[model samples]
Target: MSPALALEDLAVERGGRRLLHGLNLTLMPGQAAVLTGPNGAGKTSLLRTIAGLQRPAAGRVRCQPDAIAYAGHADGVKSALTVSENLRFWAAVFGGDQIAPALAAMDLSALGDRLAGRLSAGQRRRLGLARLAVTGRPVWVLDEPTVSLDSRSADLFRAMLAAHLAGGGAAIIATHLDLGIEALRLELSEFAAPRDAAPLSGFDAAFA
Candidate 1:
């Protein structure tokens, strides 16, 4: 089978400084990928480029747009909406009824009627993760997915991820903590950032 996604010599630059360069990575169905690096290491920027939220300065990104789901640090939840309402909206966007199961998996089933704005930080993150499950996309690009999640919630998130992989889905996660999920490792330095650079596009070559 063809790879789910491929990044060939992808490069990215931001604020006139190089964030990533010559970064090559491949994600296959059922496999998980982790972008492990310290702050300012370009992990989020790399994921953003793959998700088409940002453009590479030089190389190219190739993937099936409909088969990918991208989530950033911001859950993007409407505080005024109820849990069920928030997921209902997402189901509309992804065109499916998978949100119910996602909500249950994230432990949000009981909070379906609760306003998202009133949710705790961890609760919000769980709702955000529920989208990944409901989208049923082949690849998931997540940035700090477990950031505000409490220990139990974080564990639940990891379990959901394992189930996702078992179902032939893949993930590319930019996180500071080890989710303990089986995954390939990719470091931004492997892409070779330019010294004293800005503008976020200098690392586009890795996307080729």
Candidate 2:
């Protein structure tokens, strides 16, 4: 089968300032890819483009509908809604009953009845990840997924990602930490570096 998603000659600009140029990406089933770069290197911009939240200035991003799930820095949880309600809302939105499993996986099963706004920073981040799980999409596009997460919560998130990749799912994660995921690294900043100083193209590294 063809790759789950592909970005060909992707270029993005904002206010006449180029963010990304000559970017090409391919994600296949069961593979995980990570993007790493200094701040403002367009990692989030690339994620947003891949998620269809923003259009690339010049390029084509192709993927199957309902095949991708994205979680950005902002988790769109409603303060008034209880955790269970939030999960239910996502379930209804995604047309799946994976809410319970998602909550349980994130260790938020007991907090289901608590209002989302009452949750701590770590809790909110986990809840955001849980919402993504409910989508049940084959491809996951995550931006800074472990931000504000405690060690335990980070472990849980890593386990979730490991399971997803093992189950023929694909992911494009943008984070500063290594995440210890066996993945291909797309260093966006390298593209902006002088040609002689750039890292080799298409680098692969093992989980560490």
Candidate 3:
């Protein structure tokens, strides 16, 4: 099968500074990849570039932006909406009717009626993760997905991830925690951009 996502000689930059360069990677359907890196290793920036949240400095990402369901640092939920409503809103946007399944998967069924603003940190994170389910995208690219999750909540996340993979979806997770799943480990720091590297120019400069 063709890769769900592919990066060919990809370069990522943040704030006019190159972070990673000449990076080659591919994520196939029904598989997962974990980005292993230090704080300044450019994991988040690469993910943002793949998610189309940021423009890459050079090279190419071989996937449509819409095909990626990105869960970033922000919860991206409306505080006014309840747990179920939050999922419903995302479902409406992404053309899915799986809010109920998402709620159950994230262990948010018990808080279906609770406003997002009322949830604790862990609850909010779980709710954020649930957005991935309702997105209806083929690829899941998450950043620090289990930030505030406790043991049980982490287990729930693992089950949901496994379910996604089993159903032919792909995941690229940037995390430090061992979610107890086997995935290709991409050590981002290995591709650190050279300090003396010049920024992209001409045509590419426009997007940089």
Candidate 4:
């Protein structure tokens, strides 16, 4: 079987300047890779490049078409919609019909009828993560997925991720905190652009 995701000498550029270069990695089914680095190291850039949200300046990123589910810093939930409605919309958009299962996995059944806007930060994050299950994509690309989540919510996320991996799904996550899941660590600093180069600008730099 083909690898779930592959990168060959991948280079990422932002603001007309290169941030990451010469990155090569492959993730097979049921595997995970965690990205780690300090500010300006290009962790987010790498993830975005892999997610196809940003164009690479050089090299290639190869993955099965439409096989990726991405969850970024933004929750991507409509505040006016109820929790269940939000999941339903995503299910329709992603060509999946697993909203109920996703909600249950995220422990969000009780909040199904509540408006998303009224959810606390942790609740909102959980709802955002539930989209992954609804999509039923084989590969997940998440950036700081645990942000705003409390300890319990974080544990829930870990469990969900473990289940995904167990089911032959792969994940690439960029986070500073631990998820307590087995994953290979990919330090972006190893592929960071030269220091003499211009520093990364904007919010991407904050997370690096």
Candidate closest to the true structure, highest TM-score? 3
- Distance from true location, Cα of 104 in model 4, Å: 1.1
Candidate rank order under TM-score: 3, 4, 1, 2
- Minimum summed lDDT over a 10-residue window in model 2 is located at 199-208
lDDT of 2 by residue, 30-67 (tens): 88889988888888878888888866767788888779
Candidate 4 lDDT trough over 10 residues, lowest sum: 199-208
- Model 2 residue 56 CA deviation (Å) reads 0.6
TM-score between model 4 and native: 0.92
As for candidate 3, its clashing pairs are none
Clashing pairs in 2: none
Candidates in order, TM-scores: namely: 0.91, 0.89, 0.94, 0.92
Candidate 2: misplaced stretches above 4 Å?
Answer: 193-208
Error of 3 at 104 (Å): 0.5
Give the whole-model CA lDDT for all candidates, comma-separated. 0.83, 0.83, 0.89, 0.89
Query: At residue 61, what lDDT does model 3 achieve?
Result: 88
Clashes of 4: 0
The lDDT of model 3 is 0.89
Give the higher-TM-score candidate: 3 or 4: 3
Error of 1 at 37 (Å): 2.0
